[model samples]
Target: MKKIICLVIAYGLVFTPLSILFSCTVEAKIVSASSVLSRQQAIDFVKKAQKNQWTLTEKDYFSLSKVKSTMNPYFTSAYINEFVNVGGKNTKSGWISNLRDTDDVTGYLPYDTPGKEMTVSYSKDKKKIYVTGYANSEGDIYKVTTTLVKTKVGWRIEAIKWL
Candidate 1:
């Protein structure tokens, strides 16, 4: 009787904490997956803006802000705004009225596409994610890496590097 009881207690001690640790790991993976999905949405939004199909609203603006702070602050706006075109006249008559507008330029390009094939890799700690893919329009491949931190508003991007 004593041997059986001691063995049962020993097994419980060994497996209980291991099960808890496994549960924690699974939860972390779910969080990481959610972050990846959000990042993908952000990329799609930029693509829509590139095609002049973007609907600028408070909600959309806030969603873009999520990935903006992670990018190089100096060029972040310009990089994303590459999708928008400001309409104006450049004539010999000292130019014309400047008007900001969103239109599909002759060589406009979409930022990201779903069927373009992408690879998302995340760190074991779930604090960093890297996305690499090719742009359908330019056929140019690019990689973006971002770090995330848990915040009251869920996961917030901390930094990003485009290469």
Candidate 2:
């Protein structure tokens, strides 16, 4: 009886971890399937972000906070922290800081363009998306690259750069 009990306990310990791991993997797959991030979704997010009132002037008070709050649905925390400045005298040294100092408020990300030619690529694990597109602004077309990361809430922009 003692040997039998020891054998059963040993088997339980080994199998319990394996079962938990498998279940977690299955749950992740289910979540991913339900929230599958597609190329169209990424493109649409960029367009939406472009329309957000992110341009702020030096005189604008707490504008960055408002933008960050408004953009919370579409951007990751890290991205917001890196790009959104809180306010004057306590600026986060982010992209919004530069925008606040710039005279051209219209010169923002995802510049208003007349046409569309966005390309999207997924990471090997499909947890990240890379978007490249052209934006027409100031009577010229420029290339822009953006990265989107998959999160529990949905897909959010990680980074964007002009190229």
Candidate 3:
């Protein structure tokens, strides 16, 4: 009788948690795999950023914020700390100082000023995007690529590379 009782108790204890674990329902929220933005929409987002507004619909904001956060700190910092001189004599030192001052606001300094032309391309899987453009200050073209993933908050950038 003792042996049987112990066996039953052990079986009960082991199966009880297993039953609960198997019975519990976990539902994964599903988003459309085909919900990525059209090519035009992506380009428009860049244009808006160039204007310094960085405006986006609520849905796009999540994705945009991810890209903004991952951008080379220097590139993003230029916009956040932008300053204009009205009449101050623009010496080489003044320009360098201004660039350094921008670091105070964004904790990074831009490699160059805003670019004139911008172009973007996205992978068919919608997991990667590449942007190439010219900067007004540096007079050199740049290519920035970002990787994205979908989350509960929507699409977000996972990484950024500047070339």
Candidate 4:
């Protein structure tokens, strides 16, 4: 009886973690978007950000607080902490700080500043979106990959990579 109980407990410990891990993986795979992020929307979002009104405008940004609220639990704890707790110019340093200072979430681009127009693309899985900005005074075409995650409220920008 003791050996049988020990075996049952061991199996339970092993299977429980496997079950939880598998469930998380299945949910993570549901990131594909039904309504893809369009070029026009990206243009508008960029425009608003360049004008330094993305946070100000009622129609564009959902507000920093709203954005914070909509963030996914999957995001890194350090990223979330910095994102939520960033402060003035002296101490603030991180993606969140950059996100705050730059008008565009993908970092300030020439397209947004010069209004040069840009292109947008999506991953095959539709889990990631990219916006490529035109040449600036520096003649640089900024390729930015902005990740938006689906949440209970809808979808929210979670991370950005400016290449």
What's the lDDT for all of these models? Answer: 0.37, 0.62, 0.38, 0.43
Backbone clashes counted, model 4: 0
lDDT of 1 at 115: 63
Among these predictions, the greatest TM-score belongs to 2
Off by over 4 Å in 2: 1-34, 53-59, 85-108, 114-116, 137-140
Q: What lDDT, from 0 to 1, does candidate 1 have?
A: 0.37
Candidate 4: list runs displaced more than 4 Å.
1-34, 49-115, 134-143
The Cα RMSD in angstroms, rounded to one decimal, for candidate 2 relative to the true structure is 10.9
TM-score of each: 0.31, 0.60, 0.35, 0.39
Candidate 4 lDDT for residue 108: 28
> Which residue runs of candidate 3 sit more than 4 Å off their true CA positions?
1-34, 49-117, 146-149
Write model 2 residue lDDT over 20-64, tens digit each, in one string: 222111222233432656778778877787666354343345645
The prediction achieving the highest lDDT against the true structure is 2
Model 1 over residues 55-143: C-alpha lDDT tens digits? 22112223334333433221234543432223223344322212223332222233454466655656776554544454433354445
How well is each residue in 1-115 modelled by candidate 3, as lDDT tens digits?
1122111212246436433222333445443633565566555444444333222111222333343453322133333223222111134433222232222212221233363
**C-alpha positional error of residue 64 in candidate 3 after TM-score superposition, expressed in Å:** 18
